[model samples]
Target: MRVGSMIVRPLHHVILAAFSFIMAFPFIWMITSAFKTNDEIWAYPPVLLPDKLLWENISKAWHAAPFDLYVFNSVFVSVCIVLIQTVNSAMMAYALVHMRFPLGRPLLAIILVSYMLPGAATYLPGYIILSNLGLIDTYGGLIISNSVSVFTIFMIYQAFRQIPREVVEAAKIDGAPHRRILWTMVIPLTAPYFVVTGLITFIEMYNNYLWPSLITHNPDLYLVSAGLRSFFIEGGAYGMNWAQVMAASSFTILPLLILFIFAQKFIMKGVSQSYGVNKG
Candidate 1:
């Protein structure tokens, strides 16, 4: 048994190494191409390594548009969405899992049904609602539209259900108020799921493009994804510049990369715990 286990360990490492390379290939190509010259981009059987690195192309991409402002906007919008989604989802989940409100079961069923309807189908209706509220082209429009992430509410509800009723009754016996128990006992028990929800919301908002493109015409308020699209539309003949496009892509993805690198395990572990999977 020990000898067989020793042989399986190296095989597992080899398989994992191959999987890692497969997942990382596209990123490797993008980084290499971002630093490559125009000639290198079109070279047959393209060289992965570029001897003449072009910093100027990246510099031009950085300066050609309002990247600083775009990044700042992206950060602001993503943060707001994360917070709003977390709070709204938590509230809804708590109501579903804890509160015995009228129409509670039907309400959860409705929420689940809403998840079946794709966002694309609701786009026009959502836009009309935003226009009616006079929130178009404003940060309020962005944040409010994403307030309730069904997926998040679903995950958080699972975590909330895992909370033992005995503990809640104990809190009540200790004279802890309802809201106080929710904040202290309930939220503390589900803190890990909350972080996971926040991370997922942040990634979603950071990468969104179509909604921002349609609603906000003002160039200044654009997020990174919309800003990148504008480069191709407004940059004209220079828009075809692969170097600049790749540079913008690299810059846009860098923050997400860094964030996931640091928070990946935490989010994964949290979600797994919520769903009772992959317990460590």
Candidate 2:
């Protein structure tokens, strides 16, 4: 049995290593292609590694578009959505978990059901409403439209539910106000979940393309995703600079990668707790 187990373990390791490399190959290609020359990028056989690192690829991409403004717009929109969604979701989750309102559970059910609705189903209606409000091409338009994320609310609600009811009851018996309990106790208790939700929300908003593309026509209002699309469509020699495009894409994805690496601990904790699987 011990010899068989040893043989299986090595086989398992090899399989996992191969799978990881396969999954990571595109990103590796993207990073490497970002530094390759145009000829190298579209070479007959294609190159896995560049002959020489062309650092100019990055600078050329930066100058090819108004990435500074695009970055600022992306950061601003993502931050706004994250902040607003976190606070709102926390409040809503807290109420549903702790408050005694009759409509609370039904409201939660409705919100969860809404999550099943495809984003395509709501785009037309959302666009009409935003048009009526004259918010098109404005930051408020983008931020306000996405201020509420159903997934964030649901995840936080799950986290809040896992909190022991006895502690909340003790706080209530001690004459603590709902708001006080929520802020001072419940929120702190679920800090890991908040970090996880906020990080996810930031990444989603930053990468969002379709809604921003359809809603905002002004170049100045373009987020990173939208700006990258336009840049690719209208770019250099024969309307394409593959190296620059890859370089910009790499920079665009770097922050999210860094964030995930740094917060993976908290993210895993939050996921486990939300699923009621966290023990000890």
Candidate 3:
């Protein structure tokens, strides 16, 4: 039986490794194609390796659009979203998990249920609201509209719930006010969860295309995803620089990659706790 178990484990590992390679191939191909010329990028059977090794693709991509402004707008808007989302989520989650109040249970349930609500389903309403408020095409619109993420609320609520009530009760016994408990005890204890929430929000906001594209009519305010769409969709005179398109895609995804690498351990811990693997 032990030998059979060993054999099964190795087989599973091999299958998983192959699956991982399949999932990662597009990203690898994107990078390789970015370094190749247009012909090499779309060649039949696809060149697995880049021959040209030209840095020109990156240069062309950078010049093709207002990448710097897009990058700056993204960074500014996403940071605001991360800050607002994490802060609001932590406070709301903490309140729901640790404090008792009327209608609290149902309220928490409603918030969690919002996660299953698709953004596309709400697009028309969201657009109407933003336009009505004169927020259309403005940074104010995007940041305000996407600020409250149900996923962040739900995930952080789980993390917040796992923190022992005993510790909080002890703090209360020591005469810690509600605000003191939240600021000093609860927030400090849940720093890992906060980091996890921020990372998730950053990734989502950075990659968001549809809402931004719909609201933002000006090229100056285009996001990376929206800018890429313009090249791929709009067949103008300079349409479809395949190498440069791939290069821009590579840059668009790089920040998310770096974030995952930096916060890998914390991310794993957060998810494990979310799964009830660790309650404290």
Candidate 4:
């Protein structure tokens, strides 16, 4: 059995490595194509590498649109949404898990059920509310509309459940306020869950296209996804400037890549911990 296991483990790793390369090939192609000339891009045999690196492609792509503003808007909105959701999720999850109250279970159930509903179902009402509040086409609308996230609440709820009730009771007996106990004990113990949820929320908000497009018409308020679309249509000249398009695409996703690279360990740790908690 041990010998067979050893053979299977290496085979499993090999399969995973092959799949990883397959998934990454497009991104690799995009980065390399960014430096290729137009002729090389459509070359008969398909050019994996350019004959000469054209650094100008990067510069031209950067200057081709208001990408800097787009990036800033995306980063700012995503960060704000993440922060707001984290706090709201943590507090709500803590209450649901640790504090007993009337209709608590029903409230949690309702929230979870809402998550099961299609997000598109809520867009019309969400837009109407924002319009009534006169927040349409504003950053406040974007930030406030996404301030609450059921997924984050659920993630944190499960994490909080892993904590022993005895610990919370002990803190209560020691005269620690609920807020104090939550901030000092519960939050620290579940930091990994928060990090994982925050990263997920940031990515979702950053990549959100349909809702943002529907709400925001001003070019200056456009997120990265919208900016990329505009660039593809206008600055890219309908794919005539393939090199610059590739270059723009390559840099646009750099922030997400960097974030995932830095937070990958925490994500893995969080998932493992959650799994262990469930098994326990």
Candidate 5:
């Protein structure tokens, strides 16, 4: 049994390593292709590495479009949305978990059901409302339309439910306000979950394309995803500049990669805690 177990563990690790490489290969190829020439990129043998690194491809891509503005817009909008979602989700989750209300369970049920609905279903109404309010082609339209996220609320609710009722009751008995308990106690305890949710929200907002494209006709208001599409089709001369396109694609995901590298531990911790709470 011991020998069998040892063989199984090694096999499991090898399998996982193979799958990891397989998943990462495309990203690896993109990064490598960024340094390759147009000819090398389309080489029949598929050049895995460049004969000589062309640092100029990155510089050329940067200058090909208003990428700096697009990147700034994406970062600013994504951060703003994450901040707004964090606050609203925390408040809603706190109320749902700690505060007694007549419609609490039903409200939660409704929210969960809404989550089950496809996001595309909201586009028409969202567009009409934003149009009526005259928010189209503006940053406010982008940020305000995504202010409330059902997923963020649900994730925070799950985390908040893991807190001990007795601690909250003690705080209440001591004449502590709900806001005080939430800020000083609950939030600190669930900080990992907040980090996880914030990271997820940021990535989603940053990569969002369809909705932003539908609402904003202004090139300056384009998110990273939309900007990349534009660059690939228009700026890259309809894929004639493959190296520059690869370079642009490579750098666009840099922020997300950096974020994941830093917050990976917190994400893992949050997931484990949430899983334990659900199991309990």
Candidate 6:
């Protein structure tokens, strides 16, 4: 059995290494293509690596579009969404999990059902509601529409529910107010979930293209994804500057990559702890 296990372990490692390479290929290609010339990008034999790193790609791409404005819009929207959604979800989840309220279970069920509905299904109604409120083409419109995420609420609720009831009851017995309990006990115990959820929300909001594209007609309000689309379409004299597009793409993704690198430990810890709680 030991001999068989040793052989299987090597095979497993090999398989995982292969899968990791496959997963990383697209990103690697994007970065490499960013530094390649247009002709080199579409070279006959498909150059996996660039012979000469054209540092000009970055400057040219930045000059080609209003990337600064798009970046600002993306960062602002993503941060707002993360902050608003996290706070709202945490509060709501705490209420549903720890408080005794009428129709709480049914309310949670309704929120879960909202998650089942495709985002595309909500586009028309969401647009109509924003239009009615005269919020179209505004930051308020974007931020308000995305502030309450049912999926975030549901995930945080599960984290809240995982807390041992005895701890909460003890806090109450110690004359702790609900707000105090939430701030001191609940927040500390469940911070991992909050961080993970906020990161996920940030990524979603940053990558959002469809809703932003539809809601905002103003070019100045374009988010990174929408801006990338416009940039691709208007590649100036050299139609579809592949290298420049790839360069812009690299810039869009680099911050997210850095964030993930820093935050992945929390994500892993949170997921593991949640599962461990379930098993216990």
Give each model's whole-structure lDDT: 0.84, 0.90, 0.84, 0.93, 0.93, 0.91
Lowest-scoring 10 consecutive residues by lDDT in candidate 3? 231-240
Q: Write the per-residue lDDT of candidate 3 for residues 1-280, one digit (tens) a residue.
A: 9999999999999999999999999889989988998788778987888876989888878887777787778878899999988878878988898889999999987886787888899899999999999998899998999888888888778777767899999988999897889888887877778888898789889988888988898787888788777765574534667777788888877778888999989888867766665553
Tens digits of per-residue lDDT for model 4 on 129-155?
999999889999999999999999999
In TM-score terms, candidate 1 sits at: 0.93
Whichever of 3 and 5 has more TM-score, that candidate is 5
lDDT of 2 by residue, 43-151 (tens): 9887889999999999988887888899889988999999999889999999898999989879989999999999999999999999999998899999999999899
Which parts of model 5 are misplaced by more than 4 Å? 234-238, 278-280
Best-performing candidate as measured by TM-score: 5
Model 1, span 79-164: residue lDDT tens: 98888787788778877887788999999999899899988998999999999999899988888887778899998888888888
Candidate 6 clashes between residue pairs 3 or more apart in a chain or in different chains? none
Error of 2 at 141 (Å): 0.6
Instruction: Tell me the TM-score of model 2.
Output: 0.93
Summarize candidate 6's per-residue lDDT along 1-280 as a digit string, tens digits: 9999999999999999999999999999999999998889899989988889999999998888889899889889999999999889888998998999899989988988888999999999999999999999999999999999998998899889888999999999999998999989998999999989989999999999999999998999999998888767653543568898899999988768988999999999998998898788
What TM-scores do the predictions have?
A: 0.93, 0.93, 0.90, 0.95, 0.95, 0.95
Deviation in Å, model 3, residue 261 alpha carbon: 2.2
Model 5 agreement with the true structure over 137-209: per-residue lDDT tens digits: 9999999999999999999998888889999999999999999999999999999999999998999999999
Question: For model 4, what is the alpha-carbon lDDT of residue 16?
Answer: 100
Can you list the residue pairs that collide in candidate 5?
none
True-vs-predicted CA distance for residue 35, candidate 4, Å: 1.3
